[model samples]
Target chain A: MGAEHTHGLHLPGQSTVHRLPAHLKIVSTLAFVLLVVATPREATWPYAVHLAALMLVARTARVPAAYLATRLVVEVPFVVFAVVLPFVATGPRISVLGLSVSEPGLVAAWALLAKGTLGVLAALLLAATTEPRDLLTGLTRLRLPRQLVEIMGFMVRYVEVVTGDLRRMSIALASRGFDARSPRQWPVLATCLGALFVRSYERGERVHLAMLSRGYAGSLPVLDAAPLRVGDLVVAAALPTMAAVGMGAAVLTR
Target chain B: MHVPDGFLDLPTSLATAAVAASAVALSLRGARRELDDRAAPLAGLVATFVFAAQMINFPVAAGTSGHLIGGALAAVLVGPWTATLCLTVVLLVQGLLFADGGLSALGTNITLMGVVGVWTGYAVFRLALAVLPRRIGSVPLAAGIGGFASVPMAALTFAGLFMVGGTAPLDAGSLVAAMASVHTLIGVGEGVLTALVVGSVVAVRPDLVHGARRIRAASIQAAAPAPSSGHRA
Candidate 1:
């Protein structure tokens, strides 16, 4: 389990944002995103303010803007959908560079692009600063159900192993001249997935037996018992509080 | 099917979030019954396996490809309640860690993919299993039917959500038609994947499959001597 998979998006740093407790950072990120979502889409200034604030946090956390921008590729599909909206959306049409586009569609596109980008950036920043295990621990600390947290822990632990199994199976398939080019070849792919499932299920049983041999009852032991500090709460609240203030201002100026 | 933030109105997002949360709560209770000490870890592995399996995309059409949503697959391998929980965990991880889905729209994603996908797929799977032959051979076909229907069902659910709270003013009929048509193609890919996987598992270890448990038990009973005929007063 100590494989190279633990460092998911986490960039090691001693920055203030990175030093903050995981639960605090998680809450802060959630609150910030909620504020971003809650902001009126028509208020362009609020979005600008939100972006600036996120940038400030990124700077403090030492996460490169380029790194954040590169990860935005995940939103490419949504971006494509947003780009198409202006053409297909109904309602008041306006001429843009000789081609008529829907006015409401333009607004919808902007809202999706701006809000979606901010949300992704916020989540990326959280992942960048916090270790994957710490995030799970944070959830546990935040009083998420113990069973759910345990399952998530197992998921994070075994994802790489299962992925390795999938890769090996795919290689085996390819070695046998399987190209999966058309829908007709889906049966082979499905068989691969099936084999993977059986392998994983058997591995699961072995893991359970191993746990039982180690005197494992139902729950895993909690290792991190550190309590939250008051200072951490203040630092965590700063971003969301600023966001709230910015949103209020955006509404007022509107 | 990952709806970004601001695509729907706040009220609708919140409402869906509430529904998603309750569904998860119900799943938690239901999963407890299914996930004994032996199956709990397997349930977790099922989620992880689904996550990895979802990464593998298969071509569905000339220019398009789709991956397994794994609702029916998971519901068949594990139980439906645990399947919902597995999907929710995967979606949670994807949204929070990978930034693949929106935090604000997490509710919508979970509701559409996890709840609707699992329930619809499981319902169809059960229906297929009932109508089809009650044997190990039929498990995969039932699962395939379930998986095939689930994608479009989830798409329809998303279209419905969009109709209620879509930011862009679009014709509902066209939206549903477009979503259904495109997703129907995706559904074919889903069906093939689900069938192959379920069929393989049924071939190797039919006892491990939740959906095929009845078949396994019935086969066992048939193999054993009939107690009613053997026993005497």
Candidate 2:
């Protein structure tokens, strides 16, 4: 969980991209990703266009290119899988640099890398520009289930608290000379997790009691119910619209 | 695990999304019954705890580490219904906030991790509980087995989906074989983590555990007759 907060990826700024409503940003990001997903694997130029658009948004949001590049390590597993595909895939063989690889596998690997990278970039842009709380608020405004939203709000608030608890426990374990580096040490790690869970569950029960005493009902009150503005809608629609046009052209030309 | 977009075709993605939606809807109804006033907050906390737990990577080998998927662990602590919702919440947060998983692949992730992972893990837990000794000690063992089995099951499920609409031309047999083998190793990590967590909770607060409810109920029944007989005598 120490890594969870570190990887939250939000950088504080008041840029116009950051100023946009969370719902608008969410919609725009989803639309952009959908377009990326639907694009044919062979349509390499469309991805280039998508990347350029992402760069423009990133520049507007003042997100560093290096930061975006670093965050992409999350896709390393898929990258590995993509890399291995050409070697293992069964298809017409092609020779590149004296290495014969499956032709279809190469295409698949390219599609995966291109589309996956674009999708991750779009998601990163959204996370970088918007606060987590604001994103939940945006989900709520986007008409996500109230119960789900409430649960998510609680999760966002307490993930760090639990992780803090985990850190202290790890410190305690380390103080006791319990370093879990081997399978033999798994029991100790598990016990720590077990202890952490019990503590969290009890804390949940106590918090519920405290809230109940204060006349808390099933639902928490929503403080902000701001409606989406026309300007926000127009701005949000622009990215999707542009992507759609690109997608349409790509499909028609193909 | 966290499948990126374009791995599966559009039809497969949309289909899995539909399935995930229905599963969540069903879980919502089931969670309503599971989460009473006292339990509602615990459900949220459970999700947060899983979120936190998933962040702590335990070393499985010299170069490999794995974290708790928390499917069986959550289902054992809370009900399976609540566990699914918790996982879904975790996945959503990770996808939206962390950019860890793909937005287009959200449905597929939810289906695999939330639906398949939780249900299969819970099923194995229940099966183990039925066969194992009826002591509180058995809860963790059963959960551990369930947790261990769940990882490979989820991996196989992904392989099945890939067979249907994979964006690549790879042979299905090799994909399944590779996925299952790697995941089996990860499952060992999952099982140990689950057992440790479940055993610890059973030691301290057995009543809070959903999977151990039958054992608690049986214990109460066995204890109830003595007090009532004394009163009658």
Top model number, lDDT: 2
DockQ agreement of candidate 2 with the native complex: 0.71
Chain B TM-score, one value per candidate, order as shown: 0.93, 0.94
- Writing each residue's lDDT as its tens digit, candidate 1 over B1-233 gives 58877778778889999999899889888987887765458777888888888887787668767788898889888999999889988988887777778888889999998999999999999999999987889999999999999999999999999999888888889999999999998887788789888998888777778999888878767877676555323
Indicate the residue-level lDDT of A240 in model 2: 80
Q: For model 2, what TM-score is found for chain B? A: 0.94
Candidate 1: where is the Cα deviation over 4 Å?
A1-7, B227-233
lDDT of 2 by residue, A121-191 (tens): 99999999999889988998888788888888877878778888888998898999887786787777777
Model 2, residue A105: C-alpha shift (Å): 0.4
At residue A211, give the lDDT of candidate 1: 95
Cα lDDT for residue A80, model 1?
95
* Pairs that collide, model 1: none
Candidate 1, A1-254: lDDT as tens digits: 12232235678899999989888898898888888877877768889889999999999999998989988887888999999999999999999999999999999899889988999999899988987888898988889778888888888888878988888888888898888778888778877888888888889889999999999998889887578789888999989988898888987777
The fraction of reference A/B contacts recovered in model 2 reads 0.73
